[model samples]
Target chain A: MTREQEAAVINAVLDGDVNAYEYLVKAYEKNVYNLALRMVGNSEDAYDMSQEAFIKAYNSLHSFRGDSKFSVWLYRIVSNVCLDYLRARNRKATVSLSVENDDGEDVELDIADEASSPQALLDRSLTRDAVRRGLQALPPDHREILLLREIQGLSYEEIADTLDLEVGTVKSRIFRARKKLCAFLIKDGNIPDYVSSSKLRGGDLS
Target chain B: MNMCEYYQELISRMLDDELNNQERKVLAEHLSVCEECAAVYSAFSMLSDTVANDLVEPPEELAEDIMAHIRRAEMRKRNQREQRAKRAASRQIRNIVAAAACVAVLVAAVGGVSVVRNLRRSNAVYESRKIESSSGTTAQGGLVDATVLAPTPVPTAAPAPSSAPVSQYTAPAAESNDNGGLGSIIRSWWGGDDGWFSSPAPTPVPTYSVPQITPPGYGSTVTPEPYAPQVAQSEAAPIVVIPDTPVVTETPVVTEAPVVAETPVVTETPVVTETPVVTETPVVTETPVVTETPVVTETPVVTEAPVVTETPVVTENPVVTETPVVTETPVVTETPVVTETPVVTETPVVTETPVEPQLSMAQPDTFSDAFIPENSFAPEGMAGTPGMDMSFSALPDFEEAPADFAAVSAVSYDFSEQDCTEFVNAIFGLEEETADDAQSVQTDAAAAEANSGAEQYLSYIDKLIATEQLVPVTLPEELLPDRTESLTFSHEGFKFSLDIRFYGEQMCVLGCDGQGQQLCFMSDMSAEEYDTFVKDCLLLNEVE
Candidate 1:
């Protein structure tokens, strides 16, 4: 939809036609869900984070300001919600390991099925899994940069706006992040160390 | 690995296609010569491919779930608002009853005080008359005549001695009438003549019962204590924290500007305006040095009058004065530091220039797929199929046998393994006009050779056989003495432009430069190989 149409829907929602918000939800749901999934690293948590972000966006609809694209603004809300969840989870992870599950409180990552059979692990695409693990291993700041570039396909300027950073910082940061991920992939054996040396001998490039 | 480290970053940027033509040229040469760096490049490409290929499908119910959650939240909000309204209504009713009871109590208290005061006045009059009548009939007759003699009203005359305090009432009328013996006796008794009359008006003793004056916002009617030295009147200035209704009792005071003025709020305005201006002046003055000097001086000149008006003004001026001086010196000292902020800002612009091409290169919609061009090469619509080409240990060969020409063999050279000193010197020495001249020469020879027609077929064969060695495209006029290495060839009518370089043991064409409208070829790619690579791998439209 055009920006004007989306803005009109937003206006309708704000004008007490609360159901008009459904159009906005429908328009961005897929991308928002994908962003949340990448950020939090799990389907269930991603769903929760997506819902939380939408609810937050709805609650603070008056503050949306409309200066930026709705998608960029919405993604920022999703990113923040995921960051909050991650922070809470990290905080919980640092605490005692007592069985606090019954309280339905925030808990450390369950690590559900992260470990697989050796065959399954081998069969898994080394690049895909390694890159995923590499992304997870990076600091949140760097990881977000990679996701916005590689996954979301945001330009340096767009990422800068989303992250509230200078564009130059974004470029150098992305370069650094890609380097780190390459290092991680190499260290984790997703990429073989001797690949370049082996290819040093003459062979057909075609 | 150490040799590969430098090229590692370049390889990552290459996979992202963030490199400009110049950097790409450097990397291409490095990769051809150094297999180790080429392998790193391949790994980086594979990592990009993985991220691009793994597309996660969002849950279908996502929109529905969001809408349901919003609806639930809205319902919950509506209920909470209704409850709040009900609570507010009940609380408001309670407040009304409480206020009504307070008014009733206040009225009763005022009425009781008025009744007591009236009773005391009547008693004082009766006692005075009895005392006068008992003294002498002649004196009483004189008092009656004197009452007629007074110009004041009869009621005022009766209550004069009865209600008013003796000290306050003794002034005008008592002095003028002092010639009358009765009046003189009264004055003498009031003014230290203790023998004649011992306390004439006992009712005036209830001075403590008079209501005290209290300012608004204070809780009680009692007069407040004097202002403390450290506590300025402005600090005691009342803030109207009340939201909906104004406090009726304090309405007259809070509404009056004079009341605020009395509390030094007027003085505070100049101080408040001056403080921010003084603190801001140094910063403003440093930036616009010419105009601001006068402004700073003028502010002090304007403040000088108010400063002389009161000691408070005097104290405030020094604060503003000292603040500007202290802040100004640091700001001046920080001018160099402030100057450094722009330098830091300029660094970003320098850095930003590099990103501009990356932006123009990585155009918006296609960039997501740009890094994963490998996905487009997926055999027979096998796009997004994970683990399809995870192996980067060896270069993959396409064997559908479609091309009539034999595979263009890889010319192994490490463009990455350049000596730092030699590489820097070579790059600096290669001017664009000189390179362009060489490229023109190279293209013309290839075009002439291909235009010769018989030699065209031979050149294609020459390109394949020439892969075994580092064949430098000889410049018609030696562009570089020892460093120049590249292959130029033509197939059909098109001439291939190449810049081949040999760094130590690594020998390969470094990069392709389309100096004019002409397209160039990588060192290892013959005409047919270039065609297949373009078709199968590179998106022609994406060539930035």
Candidate 2:
């Protein structure tokens, strides 16, 4: 929904037209549910979290300042509910994808040369399954920001606003999260590394 | 790897379209040179696309479930509001009824005052008239005696000629002669006969004189002359002669003597008794009227007492009922204030004041460690150790104490029974008489504690007991002697040690929970109890 239309619907809900809330719910439910799924890594917990987020958003609808996009605000609630759920269950990240190299700088993941082109990778269902598995393996904080930026299609500033972080932190966290996902995919052998020797020589020259 | 790391972060930002043109140009230059950066860029871009397309549809019933819950919550809120309004309305009605009862009592009191005032006025009037009638009777008797003595000389002068008949006649004549002698003499003198001087004329003449004169005198005389003659005739034959003469003289006197004798009879008896009788009869009749009025007034006055008594009784009943109801509400409301502010405020001050020394002495690891050397204290400490253990085990059972106390209080207004049974059972486990005595002490202590602002703490302790948060531990009687003391076992595995000491008239029970929160319970103490408790504490200190 557009910003003005979303605000109008919110006002109607606040004015006691409870049915007006269904419009906002219907518009955002898919994105909210997918974000919750990526964060929680299970359909059942994701569904419950999404419903809780919507209810919390409706209950505190009057506190919405309209300064941010309605979806960004809704995603913030979804993110919080998911984080609280993960924290309550004490779910630790299973795989640590980002590792400090010998030079004390974060190294970008080396994707295979065969998966170099976006169009070629897009055609493969195996790459999509590998990406989903990789997203689930990332820590909750990194996964949350990545979901907001990529799946929810929020801008870096909007992701920062949703997760209550600085834009710089959002950029770095997203980069780290992407590097982790790529490393997981490469380790899983989803991408064939046909040109790794040539890339390593080029990296040493740089 | 370092140069590639910088460009890759730009690549991550660029996938989100967050790069400025200059940074994008730098990132594009680096990506063209670095093959690893290009692959990373392509993979990051492809991953973003795949995640963006990954959508999970929510269950269709989610909105319906949420709305159903909201609707139920709204309904619950509305019901609570309605119940609150109903309670407020009922409270208003009770207030109006109490106000109306007060007005009714005021009206009854005013009415009773007026009735009493009317009775006093009527009583005053009756008393004044009685005094006047009594004095009037004595004055009339004096006049009758004067008239009787005045005629005696005339009879004595004629005594020689009729001495034989005079002896017989004088006895009968003497009585009536006392009343009629003056009337007959004056009448005879006026009629030219000297009948009163001729006392020996016959006993019949004196008797006849009495009836004739006495009728006119009936009103003035204290004694009713007509009633006197009837009484005398029944008693004596000489009085019979008076009736015979009246019959004999009736025909003759009706024509001539009535004119001659009645004028003299009227003139003489009125002169002698008519004035007095006229005054006396009306006075008598007035006194009767007054007496009759008093009788009438007295009956209503007697009725007024019951009316006054009954109204006061009715007034007193409502007042009595209203006082407790009004008093109890204040006590209930004040209890919270007492508990929250005053009790909390005073507890520390009382503990710090006189009990500072005892607190320092008792601050050892265990009470028994500090107190074991004293002769009287060892048994109590040893006894109390097992008692404390029993108290912990028995703590759960005393949870029903508060509910029982509430039920008992609801059934009876007499606090002694409920307080004694609950407190004794819950805390002391003392005998019934000891419980009774302890309850009385507690009542006095409660009243004194209320004055000193420690009542709130006691009542708060009471509330805690009621809620089963605080468990009452019975202490040995020798520990505080004449003072009631109990240790409250802590909740949630908090270790607490209790210290009892007196500060002024207040008995302070101080303890610290495992979390370091200070819990102080205060009760009032009489001066004598304070002295005794102080002496015992000092004895223990000296022995130590």
Candidate 3:
């Protein structure tokens, strides 16, 4: 949990106890995979990118600057790799960069209708896949804003810098993106009308 | 504004985990009632979950490859530097060995040549003298001596000419310039190579920087000015040629180098002397500057320190929390501790949630010296509670004390509203011993038509009250300490003094009454208490 403990584990993995890398893999695997999947919009590429992000992370371990926390640094690398892969693979496909430069503290919604209570984590396996499908179907601008704000976890300021825009512009686009997401979620019957704003912003931080 | 915009700023900030105290209170209170705002909060949070659901895992083989690249790079650079170092090291060793061998060869050649030259000179001198003696020739022998010595001096003069000018070559110049016998003897005395002429020499008459009053005649002897009179001989290196002047006359040139070498040593001796001098002078000077600096610093430190500290102490004690923001900057740094919270709480300024504890978690303001009352009722309570009717009760009641606690202060039988009430008229209506007993008690009916007046009876009571010091008259100023507190009273054709202690709500008064009756009374209850006896039981209201 501490930075020292994580660094020690990283060092152990680097020393060639190849399987020891799994502790790190298990710790950060899902978040990295989710970020990649969100950025690229396809599972196969997402899976490959996630795997590659880990391999690149392991190989460039010495270059780890430690200016950011280990999770943020790894997430940044993973996010960047996803963006680059998406950019390289699809030259013809238009991908408007949203607030993609934000820091890794983005908020993600599970569509409140999925849970009986807002605080409850979604337990259904296929539900996540459905949401992923829904996310991929949306435009890149909408998807990237959602990913940066929620998945990649970037702040508006950081996203503005990465995408080259003003913070107000980033905020507006995220607003439009969330509005579109809200429309889609409401159309899909994901959240009921009774659901309130407090439950949305007050998701169980504890 | 729409509910969204109404709570828009707070909703955004709260999502960021940034609510300061007052903002949190406002928001929390709002959240308690507004269902629509709560719904918006719920929806915003759901988007948070959907956005972060998929995490991309990295490939496992990355770390080893990067390390391999770095290690190879380091090794390559190290090998390149090491190879270059090895070549330079070998070249340097070879050059040192060759230089050492050349030095040895030169020493051998110089020694051998010098020995051969000395032998030839000795042999030539012997042969010339022998030939001159055999032929009895003197001028030719002198000519031979000059030729041999003149040519021989050339090699020695060319190489060591600078030092040679002192003795080796000085003899000839000194001899030729001898215009008088004294000059010739003086030249001889200073001429010929000796220890004084070894190495190069310091200038023969070394001039240095001094308070040069060119000894009046020396100014007329301006010929010495050609060499810049009194220019320190140290300015010229002793190993160089001295000017070819009569005063320095090349004979003493070699002495310059030895003198130059000793100059630094001689100057250093005086430095050692001045170190002792400096230590002595410093002690003499140190007391004034050292003591002066501290004394100057101390008075201000001692005087201003407390003043500065006192401001901080007062401000710290005052809790000028809000007022400080207004007057904060003007107040000198004495108690700037008041505003230190500004920097620390800036984070709360943004989110404003953590700021809630300040409102709910603050200490009782009663302890703060700066807290002023906001209510009329709270003459005692601080900040003023809302519901209490403090205005009517806020100020302490300063009503007159009772003449007698047991006796009713209301309407006495001064005039009859009716001759008698049904209860009073009926003899057996009241619960007493009987009407005859009451009549027996008022039996002083005709005793000399009540010998004295009612005023006389009242005067007796006044005397009794006055003796007790409860007559409400001011006590002698001498008997009371300055600022001592006492009750103020006026009563029943008689002034009343009651030193009542405030026990929370009830004012308890302990004093002697009109009959000099000592009693203690504690009451806040209304008049009905005396009748129902819920409270206000008097210990003494006696009559005979």
lDDT of each: 0.34, 0.38, 0.29
Q: Candidates' interface RMSDs, in order?
A: 4.7, 3.3, 7.3
The DockQ leader among the candidates is 2
Question: In candidate 1, residue A51 scores what lDDT?
Answer: 85
Q: Distance from true position, residue A204, model 1, in Å?
A: 24
DockQ (C-alpha based) per candidate is 0.25, 0.30, 0.15
Name the better of 1 and 3 by TM-score: 1
Off by over 4 Å in 2: A92-125, A192-206, B96-544
Q: Where does candidate 1 stray beyond 4 Å?
A: A90-113, A116-119, A192-206, B1-38, B86-544
User: What ranking emerges by TM-score with the best candidate at the front?
Assistant: 2, 1, 3
TM-score, candidate 1, first chain? 0.76
Ranking of predictions according to lDDT: 2, 1, 3
The per-candidate TM-score of the B chain, in the order shown, comes to: 0.20, 0.25, 0.18
**How well does candidate 3 match the true structure in TM-score terms?**
0.28
Question: Where is model 1 chain B poorest over a 10-residue stretch in terms of lDDT?
Answer: B386-395
Q: After superposition, how far is residue B129 of candidate 1 from its true place, in Å?
A: 40
**Candidate 2 chain B: 10-residue stretch with minimal lDDT:** B128-137
Better of 2 and 3 by lDDT: 2
Question: What DockQ does model 2 achieve?
Answer: 0.30
Model 2 interface CAPRI class: acceptable
